[model samples]
Target: MSRRSRPRGAATAAAERRASSRALPQLELGRPTSRYGRWRAATLVLVYVLMGIHIAHWRIRGRTLAPLELNEVMYTLELGVVTAGFLFMATVCIATLLFGRFFCGWACHILALEDLCAWLLKKIRVRPKPVRSRLLLLVPPLAMFYMFLWPQVLRMLEGRPLPTLHLRSDEQGWASFQTTDFWRNLPGPGIAILTFAICGFAIVYVLGSRSFCTYVCPYGSVFRGLDRLSPGRIIAVGDCTACGACTAVCPSHVVVHEELQRYGTVVNPACLKDLECVAACPTGVVRYGVGRPPLLRGWAAWKPIRRPFDFTWGEEVWLALVTLGVLLAFRGLYDAAPFLMTLGLGVIVAYLGLCVLRTAYQRDVRIGPGWLRRAGRVTRFGVAAYAFAAAFVVFWGHSGYIRYHEFAGHRAAAEAVALAERALRAPGGETGGEPHDPGAVPGLPDPTSPTASSGDPMDEPNIVNRSASRAISHLEQCARWGLLRPPRLSDTLRRLYTLRAEARVALSDLRGAIADLERVLRLDPGAAGVHYNLGVLCATSGRDEDAVRHYSHAAALNPTDPDVFNNLGFVHLRRRAWGDAERSLRRALELQPSHALAHFNLARVLAASGRPADAARHLAAAEQLDPRLAQPADPAATP
Candidate 1:
């Protein structure tokens, strides 16, 4: 019988067999959904809210929050010190070694922000296409080396002492919970917020979610290294239908199914451990468990790594050179702007340069054009490229000029402070024994004073006041331009204020001195020296209450300093708080057995408390330590 004449049931059976034979192996035909993803989203939102609250509190109250960026670790490493941020990063690296790049998928603040950007794009029907370039993988390692390791190596080569591990334990500002001038402790607000936008959102919009991690993040390189040895992984057991669903859902563009099929586990360092593959599998073959060490997998077991984009070897070399050049060119721009912004700017410029070069090349080889026409095309292309290049050069030159002016201002301020400090240190209060000419310092002009040429070096008050005023002017210029945003620059401003206060004191401008000292304290409340100086200034100006408060702060900042304790005692004695004065003076004596001034202060406190014999013993000891205390009796003598 012909096929059409066959019984209906037999025909149906035959059709079913044919359909089964043609069936293709695939993952379940649906979008992968996971409870883990929901959990991650919820956790990330909570973390973001808490961080926002922390930053808000810091901004409003001027308090130090925990250091949150990899740059902080770089800063600590540059100084040969280990800060709390470095320890925090080290802990994350350890966790990566055990659990893979879980943080990248679950907890990283930047990634969370990028995901939000991606979701927004998706809502607008602009699905982000994942971009992968093998050549770009070189960035993270290079960044890590340059940012965190190169400085230490350079210091060593320069014969510097090994970086010290300065664990900040003091409760003033270094301690985790202490209040600080947070705005002064880190980069300026412009750089900080712009960096987040560039790295977290702008990069995502251009290169896809987590592009910063794949191509730029220095800390991600550290995590990638540790993740290779991570035993925890997603494995395919029994059988896995080679469905592309897992790859579709992978934000990192990892070939998840292929990795599992070849090595029986996902060993890609980029694997986020997001669990989407397991959730999407229909055959119940995918699982999460401790596996054989990923490093133990033989080379033969490795799958062919395919990138979404490919480049010729020459292209890769050119790209790498361009990246290195940009990195070198923008080395110190981090203080002025975000490193991400600098890198992004460099990338944009390099890409445009390449495009221009390629256009010139194409124009030179025009097929149908005569030699004259080709020459004209080449000329036009050259002019356009030159103009483009010139624009970038001018931009860079303008930036350099701004930086130079800022540097000059800082140098002038520093020179003024040095001059003032030298006068302050002169023996017998000869503050203006010899005026140092500001013009002598390189890159620093003389203060524009009408009397500068005619001024007498021995005119102590005029010289001190003029130098301090010049310093204040320079620092104020820096502040106005936001050049004093970096921690080092802010500290310079603080020192400048303190120096100006000293100059004010020399000129007997008590109110000006107090104002300058107050500014100093506001900039860096934990500065023990500034606090002590403020206390002395206040006490001399007869503001005993203000003096006591400043003295207490000084004592808290420098608990081991006998001078701080001695001054605190003196302030208490001035207030006639005999009990507090006695306690502070004794603590000062305990800190320094040879504190002769503390002995005298303690004797005064003892005499006031009616302990005449004890007072006499302290007085005898004080006179032995320093005969200046052996004076005619005065019941209200100040220490």
Candidate 2:
């Protein structure tokens, strides 16, 4: 209901009637007789029913239309995928331009969730008081900018060319309008639950109905802007009585009667065109109709409609700063927190912070008719509330510490891996067209030799070693912190193990690297890339049998990967298994006819089987494919 709407108590209604219509005859305010809420609720239910059917179709058919989410605009901006979400958002924007945000009022699942929470609270005799601040309301627009505009701005500044708009099939992943993996863009189960709890239930109970749309939803901000230009609006169709019933039933807090009185229409952008105001107007004066859009209203007819806010200007500033800080603090905490969930956390925490301030400083403070402080003295309730707020603040501080280490560890590991890749690269592109098999770092620092003292820092083995050491230390520390409070996703811990394994490889600690990789496989046995990497490491360490086993597993998981077959063939050749080696090499050649390493290995298999003519033919093919294959010191020479 409208923020200034009086409660349904007789005394409150009498006061509102006397104050709002002192000149006219007094009229009793009555509850809305309209069934718009029922219709809207049914429409929202149908939305969910369709969503369920869509998911079920994907499960049974193995493909479906991509999820229609406004946030998919991010992929459109960054990757140029003209997704179904992008088209849906555009259609909704156009609809808002004509219908004044009817979708938000009648179709959004989040709105349904908020209304359900509000209903449940009312059933329990709780009416959550809405907290309004000038600064906090800017959050929606700011978030809209961050989500939809910032990526392109960053790309322009970085001088990167915009990606070509293109479509991808399900096999290619992240298709524009269709997908095989339906949940690829969705959050994990834990994150989904947290999102519903925080954004749906917690925000509604703490900040009142539709507060997320007002203070946090980026998509709502876009619609709000479009709503200003829509001709469709609540307008006065007849005259006279202003008993304020229209204002008393507006769920968006739009102060409808005041708008109709001031501008002869509800010009407030917050209006969702729910028609509650129209249904509640006792005089039948208000109705929905097309008129001149708010922008077209001449200044002479335009009047400033002042509405009261819950916070003073200084408190609004404090609210904005605290909310921003808490938002950044909780965002992606434990690698599981989603953005909307974190935004709700920020708003709720900011409200609690304000309550603490008021209880501590203000005289005669009450929360929902229960006095927190009386006559400049604290009550027991006040003390308990203060303690709760303090504890929550401490919890947030600890979360910030964990998030810091997670980001730091990832940053360090990325740098170490990049440096190690540079260190391992051949100096002159000597491998030609041959695939650089996984886990092969050719120019690694020799375990027996002293560190290189080259003048160029890039040529120094000591620098690479030190970077790898630093990465290992950070990653280990990150894992230690994670153990103290385990993340909701096992993938986070799995990634830590995989990254640490790469660092160990850079340091030439083959045994330590194998242990870390094995731990990763335990966490995710179907990790085909991990299996391939383990195979290369085993082959490098002369465990041909183990190498063959891992390579075979990797091949089974990803049969289309030609490099897996080629590397498996090399392992077989090392074990002198001529028939198995020839079969594997031929399979690799069939997958990729230009695979130089497979041809080179087949040459060895043929020679060992006493086929000199075939050996010479395969050797000539390998040399023609990669001129560097003719060189003596090439490591693939004898494998």
When summed lDDT is taken over every stretch of 10 residues in candidate 1, the lowest stretch is: 430-439
Clashes of each: 1, 0
Give per-model TM-scores: 0.56, 0.72
Local accuracy of candidate 2 as per-residue lDDT tens digits, 42-82: 88889889989999999999889999988988988898888
Residues 407-472 of candidate 1: C-alpha lDDT, one tens digit per residue = 555767767766765565432211111111101111111123232223454665456566656656
Off by over 4 Å in 1: 1-34, 56-65, 75-82, 163-166, 169-179, 183-185, 298-304, 325-334, 352-393, 400-639
Cα lDDT computed for each candidate against the true fold: 0.65, 0.74
Best by lDDT: 2
- Model 2 stretches with alpha carbons more than 4 Å out: 1-33, 298-306, 367-371, 426-463, 466-473, 483-639
